[model samples]
Structures are given as structure tokens and as C-alpha cells.
Target: MNAEPTTPTTRATDEHLLSIDALAAWIGVSPHTVRKWVTRGPATGLVPRMLRINGQIRFRPDDVRVWLDTKEIQ
Candidate 1:
């Protein structure tokens, strides 16, 4: 009997990962701006919800949503 090759599995929760470009588009900013925001020190007042995996930066959709809510003016 031949066995099927197994493919690497990713958790369903990983679907929330957003690339820098995607996050920038969602927040109406350039990708370079997002990169700078994430890379700056905490004193710069940038959101702290970021993930760096395999040298690629990603953001969580839920975290971004929460950050936006916290930044509301009203």
C-alpha cells in the first residue's frame, strides 16, 4: 500500500496574519510608513501588535482592530 505524502499544516488561527502592505492599505498608509511605525522604539507611540516570523513582519487583524478602536477621537 502506498501512503500519501503529508503536507505541512498551518493552524486556522494563522489566517489572521496580514502582510505589511495589507495592514498599510487597511490603515490608509504606505507600507514603508507601517514598517517605520513597527520598527520604531516604544517611545514613538506606535502600536505594539506586531509579529516577526522568518524575518517577515505580520500583523494580527484583531489586534489592528483593537488599536484602531483605542485611537478613536469620539
Candidate 2:
């Protein structure tokens, strides 16, 4: 089985995730900007993927750190 964040095996309550607004605040950008990156749709985007907790968007802290690291190097 794929061990993706969206996997049901992983419960949202298992970890403290970052919401779109929180991520935006941390990145010094607007929540709308973060939303755009998450909705890359057909094309690849900044955030690899987002987690859905009770129909709300969430993100893993580790993933955010790695993503920021990659962007810093670029």
C-alpha cells in the first residue's frame, strides 16, 4: 500500500498539521497564494500535495520544511 499523506491509515489527529492560512503566514504570503500553489492541477506546483482533514486543507511540517529548503537552494 502507498504510504501517502492522504492514506486513510494516517489519521489527521495523529499530527499537528499546517493549515493554508498558517502556511501562508509562515511563508509571508497570502492564503490565496498558498491555495494557488496547492491547486497546481495539471501542472506541477510548489507544494507537492496537501492533506484533507474533515474537508479542510492541511500540511505536514516536515514536508513544508523540505519544500522551503528546496526553494531556498533554487
Best by lDDT: 1
lDDT tens digits, residue span 1-74, model 2: 97767547654555578999999998899999888887774146577457788999898887778777877754
Off by over 4 Å in 2: 1-15, 41-43
Q: Candidate 2, residue 33: CA error in Å?
A: 0.5
After TM-score superposition, the amount by which residue 54's alpha carbon in candidate 2 deviates from its true location, in angstroms, is 1.5
lDDT of 1 at 29: 89
* lDDT scores of the candidates, listed in order: 0.80, 0.77
> Where does the lowest 10-residue lDDT sum fall in candidate 2?
41-50
Estimate the TM-score for candidate 2. 0.68
lDDT of 1 by residue, 1-74 (tens): 75988776964565568998998898898988888887784346675478889999887888788888888898
Q: What is the TM-score of each candidate against the true structure?
A: 0.71, 0.68
**RMSD to truth, every model:** 5.6, 7.9
| Total backbone clashes of candidate 2, pairs 3 or more residues apart or in separate chains | 0
